[model samples]
Target chain A: MLARLRWTEFGRDPGAAIARARLISTLGPLIALLLASIFFSIRTDRFLTTENLSLITQQVAVVGVLAIGQTLIILTAGVDLSCGAVMAFGTIVMTKLAVTHGVNPFLAIALGIGVCLGFGVLNGLLVTVLRLPPFIVTLGTLNIAFALTHITSNEETIANLPDPVVFFGNTFRFAGTTITYGSVLAVALTLITWFVLTKTVGGRHVYATGNNPDAARLAGVRTRRVLLAVYATAGLLYGIAALVLVGRTGVGDPQAGQSANLDSITAVVVGGTSLFGGRGSVLGTLVGTLIVGIFRNGLQLLGVAAIYQFLITGVLVILAVAVDQLSRRRQA
Target chain B: MSAVAARVPVLEARGLVKHYGVVTALDGADFDLYPGEILALIGDNGAGKSTLIKALSGAIVPDRGEIFLNGTPVHFRNPLEARRNGIETVYQDLALAPALDIAENLFLGRELRRRDIIGIVLRVTDRPRMLREARAHIADLKINVGSMKQSVETLSGGQRQGVAVARAAAFASRVVIMDEPTAALGVRESGMVLDLIREVRARGTPVVLISHNMPQVFEIADRLHVMRLGRRVATITPASHSMTEAVALMTGAASSQGPTKG
Candidate 1:
């Protein structure tokens, strides 16, 4: 009798339906993680070590930050193909300001943030004013940002980053497990994003605008302002992530993080945020990031070559999208 | 009638004309909207009821007309202007964002921002206050909402209409116009909405309801305006005419007779 009532309640609520869908999507990654961990644990005693867990956290930090931005854009029924290039641009700007201009490192970080915001504004204006599809707009910006990164940096790595900035990444600890500042930042950001998405008015507006723009307009949401704000915020987060990436690598390389945009989007989608928008969570994206982190880590442990890793990632993206399409059809 | 008892109509349109290219959607339409009255605008589909409402609500510019507000000529350049001038329209779509919850939907356009007279900071939302007010306001209208935090997409057809009415009433200064608020609702839900319309009218806010349901029109409306072929056929008291007479006037069968007397 209790089971029957629960089923009826679930049938009546779309929120419940969405919750159920999220749960189902998570099963794939959770099972994969478990099977891989067990296989590695039996084959290699080092797999379950605290040191390996710490390594995974540090490695996942870059992709995890970018995925948060992708999650926001996807929730708004848009995509930002320029994210990876934007990170490269941010690094280039940060390096130039710090190395060439001899600016304070903290001030250089601020300058890098400003540059990303400007790029975001350009994208927002071009998309909103010109009425271009976000995909096309971001695609154009991607090439532009990529070329500009090279032009600005002269295709060279800016080495010997200021000690203060590197310190931000190098700080380490072990509290039941090894953790770094980057991982801490990533986790903190994920939590903050979860709160904002679930608890704030502006966040609700994002969902509304993404779900149905016409309805949101009539509701007087100021959708244009909201869209511009989302893009700007994404750029700012990308800038911060760029800072972390540069510090983590201990060098500002223009070509580094070239695959960030694709990897972030893959994590977001795999975590169950629909590309069509109106439904998702930051927690899901975290899980998605972990899946990627573990998959890469486990594959490397299995002696798979780095080139094969790219092919596998490509196949997984296709599989994830196909699953999403199928689930949408089922729901409809 | 005593002068105090004889209130000047809040809104009046005289010889209102509207044209869409070669189409004459409304021609010389006349309407009088009195304060504290539930006025029903009824007609067959495409009988220019919408065109006339659009003109009154300032959604479309009238080709030729004189709209008088409180006995003074007024021209609204846009819907926002009309709203400022005490005219609010709830379209058939309700215009509520589905992903947002009830509180956000209610305060979407004209949100109350915090005002600090001194150096003290303020949280504008005042969630507790807004929630309490929203809850009390909907209860005053006597509509049942499952929860204030539930998204609009979770609302039923009738409940959504109630939300739309509540939103219009909460913000509108003088007049609230509902375009087919009951057309999509169930029988009981339609009855609930009609009851809310009566409550709105009792509060001395004039309501201009556009509905096709004759029973609903007769139930809530104090005065009925019939439109036929882009012209006002007649305006009559509901108590003075049966539903049959109203429909005949609406369909143009009794256009020459004007409003049929009891």
Candidate 2:
């Protein structure tokens, strides 16, 4: 009798229905990732090889790191269009300072990261103090950072980076496959971010601020501070992404990462993090990065044209957003 | 109840004034909430009840006012300060994060940390403990919310109100001020909220209820502090006045000489 009552309760409970919806959202990307992997392995003989898998991880390292920052900003219902430009600028700062200006590599790295942090703070202050929309603020900074990168590098790629600068790009054999330190760093950062978002008070505040800023403020949350912290933290991650980029290419290419801003956003969206904010996980972002990596790599092995990758990714992004909107409408 | 005037008011305000350009929201409004009583604050549309409540709850800084808690003058620069001083408020919108779960919403700003080093050094929240305490609080109020882990957006309107009230009830050490908590609820849900208010008063914590519902106010409030033209017009109990008289005082249809002392 008790079991029957419990079953009826579960069937009728709105909370149960909502919980099921949440589960679907959280698991959707993982299932897609696995299915895509299986499909690729069947289509292309080289798709499952460790060499190609390692290469995909290596290729996604820089964008994956940038996605971490993008995920943080987007989780707060904000976007950073300047993340890629800021990262490109940071690489120039680190590589030029170390190779041309002959500053200590570590200090140059710190200075590079510091510059990104400043941009984050600048974006944050403009959003909070000036009360500007994040999209407009970040859009303005994108051009500024892009111009700064060109001026700093003088439209030149700085090469012959110091060993420490390229350390993350160095390869190490693991499980009979070559893996880059940059890939390891990207995964590590994702794990740490996942822990922070799930286990910390600041994480909760971020979600709350994104969900409803007025409600958060009335509940005694310093929503401005929370937003500032999120942007600044994202800036710090961008700086780290700059390091990974420099290490991967062994040069500071001023022209690199031009499309990375949208790419990182694509990964976040595809991974199941809502563009509207207040509901997402960084772990989902990791899965999303892999999904993009797999699709591009798989298509390449299938002898598909490069431009089709862009078309497919664009379609995936729209589908993810539509799903998010549908789920939100259901809840409403 | 007649002898309640001898005790110092738990929360008191005098000559509070607030202006938004040409519009004056609060013009020298005075308020008093005694210990362990549901004080219903009633007024017409533009009578400045919201502005007065904002000042008392620290949502806004009044242009001129003196607010006292237990006879001690207090200035709250923000809602956080008011909350720190053991005053909790449920705004008209409920002020709850819809995406957060029940336990998370219950302890939004003031989350509990584990006693161990992981929580201390890493600043991790004690989720298990918060969930347990949240369940206990909800159960104490006799609200039948199925799971504490369900996000507030998924809950029914009444359940969401229950979470807000439960949060205020759990943390409010001195006073709980609610602004039209039952305005959006159905009759049954409103009855549940009224019972919750009475239960809070029975627990010896005072409540300042702002509502336009005359019958609910008459049924629950120990005293009615009527407002007209941004000032306290009278303080009448259900025993001394009818709902018709209360409405008259609220809408300026009847004249009350001054704020009547018990």
Candidate 3:
């Protein structure tokens, strides 16, 4: 019924053109992915192999989780500079308790989650109650968290973790394929985040709060609470990702996640999520993460060094932001 | 006043006063809203219409006033409080979120949550029920909307006004107050909204419509409560006075000068 109404209203001329445009946009990324896969398959002997694909998946998993959290925060016109440091803090706290204090690994994991949730609460308090700008507040917290991680590890790496914990990190065999648990966890988080943001009341509240606080408030929506909740939830996810990071490395390093925040934010920006807020999707973020993963993997496969790949990724981020701005302007 | 055992006023205000720093916006204004009636409030710009509406809707707390709902004095801390008590104001801006679709906007503050408690929960919009109810309500008023799911941004001016009226009607239990709802609409759309106002009164919901348009006012209003400065200068029935008389009363040209903004 809706389609028929739209068809009759916007008819064959401009309507048909818009329909074509939407179809192209929906299919555009898939076409690009297929093309990239074909090009790499023809150029490189190892590109299509299970081992190489698995390596790429594991490499992007940590960054993917961070990007998902960043995407949620960014949708509310907010950013989390402390995401990386918070993850690092979680890693140190979990490892110190489990490895140094000989606490149950599961209990230590819970402790790590709790600590990260505390940081999230702090962020929420600073943003909502204190009415501080998210950028400045998170920047301060980022430095503070980074300092705490260093102090927790005593400026040294904590390694030689328990065998069971290490298994979570190193073991990747599933259905006769070499896929790590980190990769699986990343995929699960992405799906869950996507569903919540697109299909639930919690997600709609974020969009409403972002778009117009006054209207949402009039509608009986608790704007301050929703804003705080999103930031706190982001902080909690950083903690979970931190566990995966520590499990895989079999070591906890204070500096490990310091740069992950910047990379994840870049991927979110590139994934079509607006920085000014009120619009974005997890599915778009996945495609965006994939684009980054493929580009980095392809660059390395073609023997391009790390520095060049970093430079290319930086350029891609700028290009993505520019495109987003241009499209927004056109719509306006 | 021939009192035919005046039905209890749905909303009544006495000694209402508001202040912004040293400026006095409202000065002990008295108003009455009875059931099954349309009250037309008219005054010059800055004559306290905005201030009075704001106070009634809980946008501002009057410095001194006693508001009564059905003869019982009450205070609304905010607009939601007033709404929960059956007073819904359709503001000049309409208070509709432009980005949200029609259904979402209709259910904005009061979304219908499903019957569920926990784990892997499934939720779906009760679209059919909401749409059916909404359609039946509008149909009784003889208004037309192409679709309930279209964004308000895509709707024409009359359609938007219809939606706003529908929203106020859908929610309000006793009174629906419109603040210049037809001020920005085209000719035909304004007429449609006027029809809606009549239909609302017929359905027994007292409507407080604020407007300065004389013909539109005389056509729909049952009781014309003209305000000059801060006080109602005349409460003339449309059947008793011509449009010219009502305008004359509104502009303070009548023998009675009405109350000043003391």
Residue B5 of model 1 has an lDDT of: 29
Predicted structure with the largest DockQ when compared to the true one: 2
Docking band of candidate 3: acceptable
Model 2 regions more than 4 Å off: A1-13, B1-3, B258-262
How many collisions between residues are there in candidate 1? Answer: 0
| Runs with alpha carbons beyond 4 Å of true place in candidate 1 | A1-44, A100-107, A164-167, A174-178, A194-198, A304-332, B1-5, B14-30, B44-48, B54-88, B109-124, B186-192, B202-204, B228-233, B237-257, B260-262
Per-prediction DockQ, in order? 0.24, 0.51, 0.28
CA shift of A61, model 3, Å: 2.0
DockQ value of candidate 1: 0.24
lDDT of 3 at B118: 27
Higher-scoring candidate on TM-score, 1 or 3: 3
**What is residue A69's positional error in candidate 3, in angstroms?**
2.4
Q: State which candidate, 2 or 3, has the greater TM-score.
A: 2
Q: Give per-residue CA lDDT, model 2, range B1-262, as digits (tens).
A: 5427778999999999999999988888888898888989999998888888889999899999899999999999999999899899998775788889999999998989988998899889999999999999988877777678878877767778878988998999999999999998878667767877887888788999999999999999988888888888889988989999888888888887534553
lDDT of 3 by residue, A127-221 (tens): 99999999999999999999999988998898878765555466657766688788788889999988777556667778777766677777767
* B1-262: candidate 3 lDDT, tens digit per residue: 1112347788888889888888887877788877788888877777788788877777788999899999999898888889999888887764666545566667776765555542126443355666666677656566555566555555556666777787888888978988999999767668768878888888878899899898888888867666767665667767777777767876778754433211
Off by over 4 Å in 3: A1-39, A163-172, A322-327, B1-5, B116-147, B156-158, B183-192, B211-220, B224-262
Q: Top TM-score: which candidate number?
A: 2
1 against 2, candidate with superior DockQ: 2
